[model samples]
Target: MMQSTTGELSLSWSQVAARRLVRHGLDTPAQGARPAEIVRALCGAHAQVVSAAFWSIGLRSASLTSTAVKDALWSEHSLIKTFGPRGTVHLLAAQDLPLWAGALSALPPSHNGQSQEVRLTPEQTDEVVKVIAAALSDTELTIDELSEAVIAATGSWAGELVMPAFNGMWPRWRMALAQAGICGALCFGPNRGSKVTYTNPRRFLPEFAPVEERRALTWLLKSYLSAYGPATPQHFAQWLNAPRSWAKELFNALSAELEPVKVNGSLAWVVAGDSTFPSSLPQSVRLLPYFDAYAVGGQPRELLFPGRATQRALTPSGQAGNYQVLLVDGIVAGVWHQRRSGRRLDITVEAFEQLSATQRRELDEQVERIGAFLNAQPCLTLGPVNVGAHA
Candidate 1:
């Protein structure tokens, strides 16, 4: 076992990776885990690709299936679909909305690379948020329905086609959708015949209110450290898509509660109580779907994406999770893809190196687990996954 010297903990990259896998519930599935519990542990599951998000959560949970995740969202009201860290669609625990919403609300407003004409002024943004809350309160509406409500409530300018979206321009008020989510005015509802619907977040947890900003940010920082710790402020900033300077300042303010550590001889930190790691190094193989939190949140990109993984699993610009990833012992080893048809699922993996016999058995078991989660017959094919990014 590696030992720590006085006054600081020195850890190898393998140790850090192992700790992360354990925290993420990837090393071993948690028995009979609740969907909300799993989502809470990982902070949130990226849900831009809804199937990938379901698989991401189901893979880490022993008995919970994809239906359970949906139940948590629509039936039990235990999980919420919202704009989360990096302003991406995510399924966060409903109980945690106060903290997540408050921390996200504290972020400096992002322009989303929009020009002044495409963006709303601060005052206009505020007005839009107010209108969205009023429109969505105790009711669900499709984008068109909500847009009509917003335009009727505001003015003709709010409905002007300007902001570019897929194949066409979105209405001017659409720019404030994410901002409304951050302000606790919006969340996703069950689809209305393939059309997505939005409703007030308060519909889930009535009496919901954002926590105070400083307390919420502190809670968020510690939560990130607990899940992906021994990391630097820069890692935190990248994960949250917050300003680097702001992240650095927040870390400095909370320095007293952070324990400095040496990860592969580089400086990093963990929450004071979370510096210890398990003795066992991770040996489990995990097939993570696109935008999996473990794939997206792992820090020190080079260490997590060693060798060919950097080329195979990551995007050209160094973003993780654009492609499905094969993880060997908590590090990206290659790429994988799944094609589902009817009740059958075909999985193809492109590993960088040949796997040992035992690892192959584990891989098979992982495939079976996914099949059970999706209620499909599973088949695994080992070969080159000839797919483009985000395929």
Candidate 2:
């Protein structure tokens, strides 16, 4: 019998995380992946990966074919459930959607510190879905058009509806439709001149077949642990917006296949039954997109930022500062910001505290690589912090 050890794992943490992120189309390498290769790998099939990746990698928005988004829908694997985590639209993968939907749905109306007056009724939801479905039966309908159709369907019932009274109702509609196996964004017409159109999942990809909900949930939980294990139940619960009981259940299911490791004096889970060292673990710098999971996934800032400095890096409003990070040795050593003028991209480094000569050199090399990644020439500027510095 063989035991699993961290060193035996053939891949480094950065490589595994990066590869998984890129494979899911959440992060695009400076060198892009081939479209055929991407399709073959089943990239973009998971909605959480897509949404979280989009935020993590700082993509303005993924320019996906409407069809790909649709394939994720209609298959019954994913759903757009209301009152889900963050009270926003998330393209949750099929398997995890039910658990998330169920957990969120079970919460009281005032959960997440939100008001209850804005909640939607089943009848009102049905009316909106019916009208929107009918109006968009043949073509893509924009947000305005969908809203109009929804309002029209209500007719005399419109004034009595809670959705119409609230501005946040659109996301509720989106969530409901997602639960029904419809996913994808409203297509914006060229020149921003035409009305938005609703792109149906069936119309986008004709091959999607609904999968069993239990299987989908199990697979999603497994993927979460595999990619982000060594995490605590609280962390998992937070990320999935699930209850402690639900998260515990899922986490226990994989206990036999996961090993516990100590990270910063705390227990974290890691994949079990594998023994291979990763090919390489290079020190690379990346400008993570806002809302990146590396920053959001775990509960405390110690994983990515120093505990003492977390307050300064993350504002009271929960927004990360403007500085691009220096990911030296897989730990955030300091912050960097770019100033672009004409063909020049000047990068300024702000060390967390102070750097040794060796650390400084490492930082420089990492910045150089970052320059190349951005397709710009590197001009390094080093100095002490100013009272109010602007990047």
Candidate 3:
């Protein structure tokens, strides 16, 4: 019998989470997709819009049109907005939104009262609703069109213009739509300036049904733990951008289903009842897009990549940038990007550090798989290794 190496024996918490995502069909190797495979992997039986979006990007590395992304949103999932831990736009399922929002709401704003002032108030929000209803009821509007209508409805209140002004606007709109019980996106054809139309959530997904708020929250928490567990309250809190108290409460409620594992001396939650590790791992390469959930969703991403390498992957402002990640043996080994010149796809691979001869051969083989997935020929350009070296 072949013995498992110490590295394999001492599985990192990140690998544990990645394995669960794959088993649940939430993630796939970088080998591309067909539309049907995409739908089947994501929709499963639950059939939520968000899961579809997650499935699409996780498997294909493609960003669906707003409509495609929104088609996954459902009222059974709660959507709310508050500056989460990393202070970014995150569209969560409705049932999961309240506790997440409630947790964040309880925290002091990072910038004192000034930051809070920028958020919409109940009255102002009511006006926003009226405008959105009026504009979207009859026709679909682009983000710009919706922004104009909101400005008109609220007499140009700062909140109406807020969505367009901040980079965080999309998540805010998702929150608004979830609150209104109007899930789904108004996708545009070609460009934002082109024709746009509203789509019904039910029409896109017939199986989803709205559930009670409390029940939704419970289900949402379970789903998060199921897909992203082997994590801690801090990881949960960070992922939702909520408070420690809320994270603790959810973890406490989920105690029966979660197994505590000692990782690097810290306790992390793993899915209860599962003891087997994945027997066969994919031998393909993946190019994860910027802001990919796998990188951002995990708390202390060092579990995925080294600290110095992680910093280089993100923007100077600490935001995820548009970088293509290179995955080998189911872990992030390096980063890659493509320069397109009409018909040719010029690929560059930047290793976190020097690759062993075996790793290099594996990378070359994996790149071929990537080429097959994209249906294009790849011209490989190797960049300097930066894993262990200072930048």
Provide the TM-score for each candidate, comma-separated. Answer: 0.98, 0.61, 0.65
Best by TM-score: 1
Instruction: Tell me the tens digit of each residue's lDDT in model 1 across 58-160.
Output: 9998888888888888999898998999988999999999999899999988898999777899999999999999999989999999999999999999999
lDDT score for residue 219 of model 1: 96
Candidate 2 lands at a TM-score of 0.61
Question: What's the distance in Å from true for residue 88, model 3?
Answer: 6.2
Quality of model 2 by C-alpha lDDT: 0.45
TM-score winner, 1 or 2? 1
Stretch of 10 with least lDDT, candidate 1: 1-10
* Prediction 3 TM-score vs. true: 0.65
Task: Please identify model 2 stretches exceeding 4 Å from their true place.
Answer: 1-114, 126-138, 155-198, 253-265, 271-282, 298-300, 317-324, 338-348, 355-391
Against the hidden true structure, what lDDT does model 3 obtain? Answer: 0.48
Off by over 4 Å in 1: 1-6
Model 2: residue 53 alpha-carbon error in angstroms: 6.1
The Cα error of candidate 1 at residue 50, in Å, is: 0.8
Candidate 2 structure quality by residue, lDDT tens digits, 1-391: 1223543223334544443344334343333432222322321222233333322322212233333333333333233211234343344443333344344443333233324555456676556555555665567556665656666666644434334324544444442443333222221111234442344433433443334545545555555555455457777676655677776776687677666654444455666653232344443444443344444443445545665346545655443333345444445556655567865778776666677777677657655644544455778887543433222
What lDDT does each candidate get?
0.91, 0.45, 0.48
